[model samples]
Target: MEENNKIFDDEEEELYEHFSLDVDPGQTPMRLDKLLAIHLKKSSRNKIQNAIDSQSVRVNGQVVKSSYKPKPGDRIVVALPKPPREPTEILPENIPLNIVYEDEAVLIVNKDAQMVVHPGFANWDGTLVNALVYHFGQLPTSKNGAIRPGLVHRIDKGTSGLLVIAKTEYAMQHLARQFADHSTERTYYALIWGEPEQDKGTINAKLGRSQKDRRVTEVYEDGGYGREAITHYEVLKRMRYVSLVKCNLETGRTHQIRAHMKYIGHPLFGDATYGGDRILRGNMFSKYKQFVENCFQILPRQALHAKSLGFEHPEKKEWMQFDSELPEDMQTLLEKWEAYVQHV
Candidate 1:
């Protein structure tokens, strides 16, 4: 065990750790999976082999097979998802989930606006993961002992929407690939301050953490920095002060919809991070301000909802899509805005 030195790197959010090991100078040539099995105590041989089959285990950045022999001085990395979660640190809590769809392979949840998807930092309990641990017995974890068991993707804590949690290792791998390839269909509904110039348009921008505010994401319109993010939006309805919009995600980068909408000068209604909290439109009359304030009181969080999600079934290999009705807060907010628009 002393000969096999593992390197740990930290990342933000639901990240799997890169289980990195430098092959010992005196290392004997053996199958890669076997070597990994020795280092990763919690994992079994079959799970290691499955990881190799999925092209997840790489040798010096090159994907390798289970049978591939690692020579001395070779850097072997089991590329699991980022910043691994310790299973022991997370305790199961009986938090209720609005499960939209569930089969042996996957669980589609309509996560609430206030709920954090997983436990982290200040939000160490009462998360979706805590609920998941309680709801199911032994959901499959990925190889390299990376333990965001079953969770493939996530919506923001304040953004209510659909999330697909994989139940099996195979399903996790399959669904993760779909998201990585940007093949999964994700559509969100947002009530934004200010209407778009056109009814429908595409926002092609690069997104990364803001230089000014590391906590929030920013849009890079010039495209020299950040990862590519595309959002196709259509105006569903336009009030004088705000517009109800539908957004389809082409690439699911962090804060893609939120950042892009803000970049285009129409931040999601009530979003404090990107400057939507103030009255972006409407008259200066106290009556209008009072109405907008009333609307804000109705929906306090960012006015964004993941309305629908679609992906191919991991085992069944058929297209599966899930949709949810807007949660009560957002629905009531829309009604309030509609009435205000009509009268004033």
Candidate 2:
């Protein structure tokens, strides 16, 4: 039994990963760098491309050009250097990042839904790192020696869309000060579960950490480590149950959008924890309840996306603005609701 087990382990170690390569006859001669990026998960396109440019990659026993074409049965050999454990930031992930614009000092990255901006306890990998590491050069780190040196402002774990990050320490400090002074203009698009009786309103409430549940913040009336929170909202489109509204933050607070929306009796769609029961019960929007329920089942949380951001470049003394469109999932839900309303 011991001998069999040893033999099994030996076979697994000796097994070479094998993959077949196929190229179309008419397709212009593709580069070796492109081939490797498409083939290997352990390696990225930029790394392989750099190696080829530096004359490090070999094909069929010869140093070849990046655009070298391979004949049928050609043996391609890549002399890949050992990649660093922690590489520098790279391009915005093709992971559907909605980039508004970019400049030398900073880049506006429109974050996707359900993406954690920086590394934390629950998420170590498969994050923006997997994208930034492959896209840009290594960013400058703080004295603390942690990665993600460019990151300046951070949205919530589940919130989506335009958030700014500093490309340099000077830029980072300046942007941080902007947030401190409440000069940055941030706007969010939310599909709430209820229609506000008024077309526009403000939620002025003091928010503090809930003593019973430290994880959440609540509208504290008494003794609590609270801060002044204010949110202004305007209805863009209205349905029987759900209303699409644009929310502006007067002050940045934890869960400001979720909490303020709920306080106004218009919790965001699919928000289960923060008073989204109206949408969940599938009773309010009776005509499109089935569609809304299907959307809720597909979505992990509330329907909120950061649609626009405008702020001054602290260093450059220039105004910068960014905008992101609603994602397809949310768009589909809106379409269904609109169609249902039209039919009625």
Candidate 3:
């Protein structure tokens, strides 16, 4: 039957094939299934199981189980399967938010620090996505199959800033395309440890994951999973031991400002991960040391805020921009820091 043939063709195309095997001298052999997956870029344990079940994989001209191990000279073949398709899950929640701007196609919200954009391990609820799902039924899915829905771009969990969320598929596509073209205007304010000699400059670096610690990113010289990141910054104000800086993002990379600032010897105040020791040390008060030590508190959180966002509306074809003033906590922190300088 033509339908049966079509199904078989699809299955055959889905299966991986002609995987290579290389074993070290005087070493025990590893499983053929593992080798095949590594070689053919085919992942997912279920897909491997399905391939083994259909007898589409061969180990040295012999059909083998999924657990079969291969020797150094053994030739391996695997049938790669077409990736399975799954519907996107968009759950709703009634989380609090500070919405700055909203139109039919797009929304700009002042994303508070410490809130994730979507769900993951250890953070299933209280995300921006959860709030959006509660407000809107669903989000536009991306062609690249990113897990988070409605998010065109992202700021870090600890970075408070204006974020754009899409309301429709058409808007999502257009906005994503605009971000890809580097037309969106994004700027932030941060308090850093020291002042740079130049008022305006750019930090161009390649970033990648750290091999020693997968959780942290590092500036890689040889380009390991790394991408080019550019951050333009200007000194807004210079204090006795700290400086206020404004940053413009040319390329949006994870921890771009934090990492790049640290790389340039001006880590953000209250940014423990990227070196806020200067802020903590500079503000050392012997009388308050015991209290701060007991509480394990430092600069509340890096004094970073998303000041402005600019973009073209997806449906209206109108240029739009929104701004958010500093929250009370940040304003208070700045006030204390400025007073400390005035006394000296």
RMSD of each: 10.5, 19.9, 9.5
> Number of the top candidate by TM-score?
1
How do the candidates rank by TM-score, highest first?
1, 3, 2
Assess each prediction's global lDDT (C-alpha) against the native.
0.84, 0.68, 0.72
Model 2 TM-score is: 0.66
lDDT of 1 by residue, 188-289 (tens): 999999878999999988887765555689876666567888899999999877999999999998888888988999999999888888888877788888
Better of 2 and 3 by lDDT: 3
Question: Candidate 1 vs candidate 3: which has greater lDDT?
Answer: 1
lDDT of 1 at 95: 86
- lDDT string, candidate 2, 15-94, tens digits: 22232244444445556666667665676565566556655455555678877766555555444333223433333454
lDDT of 3 by residue, 1-344 (tens): 00011232323554444343435355366676675565556456545654666676666657898788876566555544443443356568888888888778888889888888777656767888888878877778677875567799987777787999888899999999988888999899988877788999998888755545445667765543477988999998887667889999888887888888888888888777776743343557774455334322434676688889999999889899888887666666667667666876
TM-score of each: 0.75, 0.66, 0.73
Cα shift from native, residue 134, model 1 (Å):
0.6
